[model samples]
Target chain A: MKVRVHVSLKNGVLDPQGRAIHHALEGLGFDGVNDVRAGRLIELDVADTIADEALDEMCRKLLANMVIENYRIEKVAA
Target chain B: MPFTAAVITFPGSNCDRDMAVAIEEISGGTVHRVWHGDAALPDGLDLIALPGGFSYGDYLRSGAMAARSPVMQAVVEQAGRGVPVLGVCNGFQVLTEAGLLPGALMRNAGIRFVCRDVKLKVENASSLFTSAYLPGQTITIPVAHHDGNYYADAETLDRLEGEGRVAFRYLEACNGSQRDIAGVLNEKGNVLGMMPHPERMIEPAHGGSDGRKLFESVLHGLNALA
Candidate 1:
């Protein structure tokens, strides 16, 4: 089994990298871009029998920092 | 009574020696060098410092690997027992990664490494780390890192400020830190995590010695406790 974790900075938090990217897009003549927020996608290969609780623990403990980022877990069948 | 301090050195910790020198010079006591692989720390430690640098080459996130090392387990236990722990730069990252401190340090908002002297306002003068400074006083300290931008949720930030847990705040915009937080103290006030390298500013030859007061303050606090 494989799992994917999507980590993103919470709303209302300043995302400088995202802002820079948005600026670049505007300079490139792309309009209608309201905002840009950068995030990370982490893929994990775990045991087939891994439980959802364990995966949640992994995200809470190491995969994502709850203070600045939020994470969502997605299970993908291998 | 001499102060006994330990400086933990992880593989890639470039500032461990500098931290030890500052502790020894300020406390006028024995400075023990502890390795990251050690499962236990020296007995009766008055202070434990985690110095800055790309610990574990900043793999899997800055300070993530080093934070899970055997030695950090001991450091956490010691900190829980009320021993003062100061984490600087990458050390600050390690403290947050190890769950000893609140919040995490992220990459600079500008996507460029920032290296220069930054003015910080002392917010809490009661912690073992910042007692030497007056509230609202600004002090200049050097910051050199790519991941010095601090981040925390709004509620957590509010709680930290309300509880007087915020130890230092940037006087000007140096990084994209939320609330301009440059440093913070743990709930117990015995642990501190900051991006500025106070250890680097302890010697006059380093351009300024304004940071010496931090070490002196911790030593005084420990001595009073003794």
Candidate 2:
């Protein structure tokens, strides 16, 4: 089994990198870009028998920082 | 008795020696160098410092890998026992990742690595780390890192401010830290995590010695306890 964790800064947290990207896009003459928030995607290849609780624990412990970021776990069949 | 301090060195810790030198100079004691792989800490440790650097090359996340090292387990236990722990720069990241401190340090708000002296307001002067300073006093310390922006939920921020857990706040806007927090103390006041390198500012040759007070404060607190 494979899992993908999408980690993102919570709403109201300032996203500096995302803001810079948004600025660059405007400089390139692109319009209608209201906002941009940056995040990370991590793919994990684990054993098939890993439980959901264990995966959630992994996210809570290492995959995402609960204080500032939230993580979503997506299981993809191999 | 001279203070007995330990400086934990992870593989990529570049500031461990600086931290040790500051502690030794301020406390007039020898600093024990502990490796990250060690499963136990030296007995009678008055203080344990996690120095700044790109631990584990900042892979996975800043301080993420080093936070899970064998030595950190011992550090956490020691912290729980009321031993003072100061985490600076990457060390701060490690503390938050290890669940020893609240909040996460994200990439700088400017998206560029910020390296310069930043003014910080001493919010709480009661912690072992900040006792030498006056409450609401402003001090200048150097901050150099890409991931120095601090973040926490609104409720956590309120709780920290209400409980007097916020140790330091940026006097000037430097990073995009929520509430302009440059440093914070744990609920017990024994553990502190901050992005500014107080160790770097301990020597006059390094520019200013304003940071010397932090080490002196911790040493004094520990001596009083002893």
For candidate 1, write residues B1-226 as lDDT tens digits: 7899999999999999999999898888999999999999999888999999999899767888898899999999999999899999999999999999888898898889999999999999888998888888889999999998898878889999999999999998887888999999999999999999999898789999879999989987877777
Clash pairs (backbone) in predicted model 2: none
Please write out the lDDT profile of model 2 over residues B29-98, one tens digit for every residue.
9799999999999988899999999999999789999999999999999999999999999999999999
Cα deviation in Å at residue B70, candidate 2? 1.3
lDDT per residue, candidate 2, A1-78, as tens digits? 889999998887788889999999999999999999889999999999889999999999887877778899999888
Candidate 2 regions exceeding 4 Å error are none
lDDT of 1 at B50: 95
Worst 10 residues of 2 chain B by lDDT: B217-226
Native A-B interface contacts kept, per candidate: 0.61, 0.94
Q: Candidate 2, DockQ to 2 decimals?
A: 0.80
